[model samples]
Target: MRYDFLIIGSGITGTMIARELSKYDAKTIVLEKENDAANHATSANSAIIHSGYDPDPGSLKAKLNVEGNLLYDVLEKELDIPLYNNGAFMVAHDKDEEGLLQRYYERAKTNGVPGVEILDQQQARALEKNLADDVTKVLNLPSTKVTYPWEVAIAALENAVDNGVSFAKNKQVVSITADNEGYTVKTEDGTTYHTRYVINAAGAYTEKIAKMIEKKVPYHITPRKGEYMILDRRVAGFIQRTLYPTPDEKGKGILMVPQYHGNILIGPNSEHQASLDDVSTSKGGLKIVKEGALKLAKNIPFHKNIRTFSGVRASSSHKDFYIKESLEHSGFIHVAGIDSPGLTAAPAIAKYVVDTIIRPKETLIDNKTFNPCRKAITLYDDMSAEEKSVAFQSDARYGNLVCKCERVTEGDIVRHIHRSVNADSVKAVKKRSRAGAGLCQGGYCEHQVIKILAREFGKTPLEINYFSDQSNILKNETKVKK
Candidate 1:
């Protein structure tokens, strides 16, 4: 299908951009290589809405992060997503770190981040009782928040789709050629799409997409891996807000984030690598994460840890967001090198790209039928007793428990399967609903999820994949007793 704009990724940047563009009267399509949105870096991250205090002053990361942080309050109501603005603290354990906190406070003040203050030991301890004894000072950032990274991207993509934006999944852009009129993008499946504008938001592979135009792009992307550990919900209250160590050149130091879903997250030491797809958590990297996090919050319950994983950020050599219409290519826009505060900077970035970059070149009328509100799925676990009864009365599937650990019912799974961004794999369902993300880690509910997927998609259990197409769980069938 021909489109006015073709976005080459389905992460936060691309999906948010698509949602913003959908407000205009134009045909937009988002091409995602994965089976679902947020299958890559967006799925795994610290999930913190940064307060815009960490990035260097006057950089794109700083400007967009502060602006994007302010957009979430309205976005939460519009999209019906979870967001916890409990605030954040950067603790200092020594004189050097205390000086670092002072610098950070000044930087936040200069950047216009709201409610930033420097707290002494007594004040910091009053807010976070688990602060290490050696911590001398703390930088309080009241605007900091926590959110599910995948949920934001998926919700934005779904809202865009609801507002007339089309999404083509599993369509990997392999090549692009610019003609006199526009650009022609070819996918790995041999399908070609013609568009007036090509937005390069492909996380990790963004540089490669830019090079496809003329075989050379200005910047290079270094995939930096960050390892993390998720503790059980019992330890979720170990800290009242996100805790951080003093900043460094690499990125925000390993942090302790209290997830909005009543869980705890920690770690994410930066390890730069050349491989774009290396999300493997190493033994040493995770060790560094635990050691670093313990320094900020000494009372962490390490034995309560349930899951360990990693995500790769697209770090560019330029060290700032590489967002501009390619000087070499006319219609191509590069939103690359978006790391650290990229998630927090996404909304502002979308608006900036649309308002400052695209609108100046092309005139776009407002789409009159554009709707911003999206109804979220009915979660059985979060409802009251009366609400549960009403839900059960409406559907018998809600009465049947599919995942005991998370209290996920069959109705929840079925509802998520039929949405605009449906769950196609076991991992997709897990992300949509908390079916397989409980303490058991799908050990008890995986078979049920597989069966449900097979039934919903009209495919055999052998055809269903775990996450990717190549990772099919059920490979062969055995002879059953007749």
Candidate 2:
């Protein structure tokens, strides 16, 4: 089918861009290589709405970061997603680091990040009592927030789909040929897509996509790996807000962040990897995370560790977001190297691409039927007692709890499976409903989730996979009555 725009990758950047374009008279399609959105760096990162203090002043990252940070309030309301402005504390360990705090404060002021304050040790400890004794100063940023990155991507893409943008999953783009009309994108599955405009937001594979059009694209992507460890919800209130150490070249140092749902997360020591798909967490990396996190908050209960996972960032060699229409190809735009501040900069970048870049090139009109509101999945815990009784009466499956740790019901899993962007696998269900993401890590609810998925999709338990189709959980069928 011929489309006005084809977005490569279903990460936050691509999905957000698709959402922005859906507001106008454009036929857009988002092609995802994975089975679901945010399967790579989008789902696995620190999940923080940075207050735009870190990026160099006047860079694309800084401009978009601040603009996107301001949009979360409206986004959270419209998308019905969870976002907590729980604030942040950049702690200083000693006199030298205290100097760094002053420098960061100056940067924050220059970047137009509001409500930033330089606090001494007494003021810092007043906010977080568990801070290390050696911490002499702190940079208190009241605008820093936390969110589930994958959920945000899902909400945006789902809203876009609701507004008439088509979505295709597991379609890995192999090559693109520029034509007089536009570009013809060929996928690995022998299917071709014709589009008048192409936006390359393929996360780690963005540089590869750019090179697909121009052989010498003047930029490269390095997969910088960052490992993280999540503690159980029992450690939620231990450190109230996101806590950070002094800055370094790698990125934001180890942060002790509180998830919006009350879980505690730590680590993310920056380690650059040679491979784009290497998201495996190493033992040494976890150890370094533990040491680095404990240096900021000393009383964390390491025994409460629940899960460990890693993400590979799309670190650009250019050191800033590479967003611009290609000089080599007319209709091809590049949105690559969006790493650290990406999650926070996504919406603004999407708006910039659509309003500033594409609209001027083409005669596009507004899609009057566009609706920004998207209904979110209802969780058992978020409901009032009266609402719960009414909901359970309407759908008896709501009474059947699938994930006891997270209070996820069977109805929740079933709803996710049948949503706009259906949650097809165990991991997708976990991302959508938090079924297998608790302390047990699917040890208790995995089979139940697989059973629900199998029933919903008309498959057997053995046919269900974890994340990818190749990673099947059940190898073969056991004893079954005929």
Candidate 3:
């Protein structure tokens, strides 16, 4: 089918663009390579909405990050996603680090970031008691926030799909050829899509996708891996705000991120990788995270660490965000090399792409029926007794708790499975509903989730995958079915 816009990836940037374009009367479609959306870098990260202080003064990361940080006030309300605006602290361990904090404060002012100030050690320690003993000063950024990164992508894409945008999974674009009318994007599965404007937001694969059409792409993208650790919810209140250990050349060093869903996240030590697929965490990488996290906050319950994972960032040779139309290909837009602060800048980036870049070139009418609101998944634990009774009356599955750690009910999992962007895999379900993302890490509830998925998808337990198509949880049936 010919579309007005064909988005190459389903990450936060692509999905946000899709959601923005859905407000127009254009035929937009988002193509994802994996079996689900946001399975890569978007799903794994620090999940911090940066305050726009770290990026250089006149860069796109600075301009869009400040704008995007403010847009979340409306996005969280419209999309029904939880956003924790608890703010962050950039701790300065000594006098030298205090100088760096002052420089960041000036940069924040230059970038038009609001509500930034430096607090003395006594005042800083008053706000957060877990600071390291050597802390001399703190740079307070009240605009910073935390959220469920993957859930934001999912919510945006789901709202986009509901507003007439099409989304397809497992559609890896292998080749792109320009024609008189438009471009033909052919996937690995022999499927072809004809679109006038192609948006290359393919995260780590952005450079490769650009090379398919333009022989001499201006920039090269190398995948940089950042390993992270998630502490159990029991340690959620250990820190009230995201804590940073100042800035370094590698990127924002290890941070103590208070995730929106009552979990503490740490690590994300940066290291360049030769391959984009190398998201594997190492003992050495994790050791750096453990030691670095100690500098920001003392007496952290390391025993509460529940999971360790890594995400690959699309680091470009340009040293800044490469956002512009291809000089050789008129309609092709490249939103590449969006590494750090990419999550915080996504909303503004989408607006710029749709309103500034695309609209001036092409005439687009408003989609009159577009609705920004997406129905939020009900958390059984958050419901009142009366609400719970009403939910149980409507669906008996509401009474059955599938995930004891998170208090997720069968009804919650089923609703996510039947949403606009369905959760077909165990990981997808976990991202949307937090069914298996608790202390036990799915040990107690994975089998039950598999059973539910089998019944809902009309397949046997062996067919239910953990995330990818090849990573099936059940290798074979142990016994004969009755």
Q: If ranked by lDDT, best first, what sequence of candidates would result?
A: 3, 2, 1
Assess candidate 3 and give its TM-score to the true structure. 0.98
Candidate 1 lDDT over residue span 140-234, tens digit each = 99999999888899999999999999999889899999976789999999999999899999989999899899556888998999999999877
* TM-scores of all candidate predictions against the true structure: 0.98, 0.98, 0.98
- Candidate 1's TM-score: 0.98
Ten contiguous residues minimizing lDDT sum, candidate 2: 210-219
Clashing pairs in 2: none
Per-model tally of clashing residue pairs: 0, 0, 0
Per-residue alpha-carbon lDDT of candidate 3 for residues 1-482, written as tens digits (9 for 90 to 100): 78999999999999999999999999999999888999988998899888899999999889999999999889989998789999999999788999999999999999998999999999999999988888999999999999889999999999999999999997889999998888999999999999999999999899999999997898999788999899889887889999998889888899999888788999889998899878888999999999999899899898888999999989999888899999999999999999988888999999999878898998889999999999797786788899989988999998899999888999989988988898888998998889989989999999999999999999988999887777898887768888
Judging by lDDT against the true structure, name the best candidate. Answer: 3
Instruction: Name the lDDT value of residue 477 in candidate 3.
Output: 70
